[model samples]
Target: MERSKTVRKGTAYWILGVFAIIWAVITLYPFIVTIFSSLKTNDEILGSMLNLPRDPVWHNYYVAITGAKTLHTIMNSIFLAVCSTAGVLLFGSMLAYVISRKKHKYNKIIFTIFLTGIVLPIYATLVPMMKMISKIDILQPNAFYTLILIYIAICLPEGLFIMAGYMRGISRELDEAAIIDGCNTPQLFFRILLPISKPALATSAIITFLACYNEMIFALLFITDKAKYTVSIGLLYFVGKKTTDMGPMFAAIILTTLPMLVFYMLFQEKIQSGLTAGAVKG
Candidate 1:
């Protein structure tokens, strides 16, 4: 009986190990190919897709960073992502705190309206958004601030939802105590609630920033100036009407992805904690 059970457990372990390897390959293959392509020259990339580079060309990294347009694009992307994240966190959290703590019929209505934004597909509003942008003339040409506002608007729903859900888990006793101490609404949120909800805040900030960083369609549609283009838009410039430069394009792709990967790696623990905390409480 013992020998039979041991054999069965060993078989299960082997199958699980095989499946893990397959899953890793499925998720990681494209990234591996991108890294491989980034190390090769255009000619080498065209000649061989599967084979490793004979002589690794490291200049692709230099070209990606030192190129004037690429440098500008990187800065634009960083500014948009960071500013949008900040706006969403500050505004969304405040709105969420009010809704979660206050007992009012209008709060429920406002919350529902904000929640509706999540259900609506952003692409469906493109025409209207573009019309407004044209009328406002703020994002004219390639202004980074224009993209920042758009990103903040797009990210608000999710940020609010996550924060409100997190606020539900917080004890009401804290609010009562703050009120007893003569703290106003703004003081209560900034001093007490905001510090305690750091996990959720980090999660929302990272997600919002990444969304703005990776956004392409609106960036392409609104941004006409090369200097104001984000990394996503700038990376596409490597492709021509007739042919695509696979090597440098891959290098640019890797460069664009590296920041996000690093951000995730740095804050992965906080993200996981925030997600888990929200899930468990909500």
Candidate 2:
């Protein structure tokens, strides 16, 4: 009976392995097709989508970067991503720390308001957001600083929620100790809580940055300036006189996607470790 059970388990594992392989291939099909499509000419792509590039044209990458201004937009996106992420981390963490630790009647009300922003769709406020941006003389969405500020604002609620939860996991003893050692609230927060919350911060930062990085609607609607356009808005480079600019666009898409791929590759382990170690239990 033991031997028979062992054989059945082995057979089940093999069947599952086959299904997993098939699923992986299915998932990867579009990306694989895109890579090959980027290398092939339009005629070749039209002729046979499945065929390998017999003579790969590498200039598509160069053209997409240089001629299509993909590299510049990518640079624009990086700057925006970094600045917006920093703002979210610095401001969001501070807000969370105060709200989570401060025992006041208004604390719950404030936190509830912040959480409600999660369910508020950006589309609902599009017109008002535009009017508000226009109303602020120096705060045009086309301006990089203005755009980053908007990103930070939109990102704050979720970050605040995550950081607040994570902060609760840290003991109040540390705060008491810091206060006894002549530390102010700011100092205790900056010096003690900040270091302890690194994992939660990392998790929130990565998630927020990626969301802002890939966001399209705000980028498209707010920024009319071509030079200030992000990678999400850079897809217009693919549209030509009559049809889509397939070849160069494919290359651009891959180039646009590479940064995210590289970012995940570097920080995926950190994200996993951080979530396990830093997240709150209850």
Question: Residue-pair clashes per candidate, as listed?
Answer: 0, 0
RMSD of model 2 against the true structure = 3.0
Number of colliding residue pairs in model 1: 0
Q: Report the C-alpha lDDT of model 1 over 1-282, residue by residue, as the tens digit.
A: 999988987989799999999999989987898899888988888887787988888887777776635666777889888999999999999988988888988997898788788777889988987888888855564677777788888889888888888898999999999999999988999999999988778878867777788899889988987668888889777666333456666777887778778877987887666556544533
Per-residue lDDT value at 89 in model 1: 98
Name the TM-score of candidate 1: 0.88
lDDT of each: 0.81, 0.83
Regions of model 1 farther than 4 Å from truth: 1-8, 138-141, 239-245, 272-282
As a whole number from 0 to 100, the lDDT of residue 178 in candidate 2 is 87
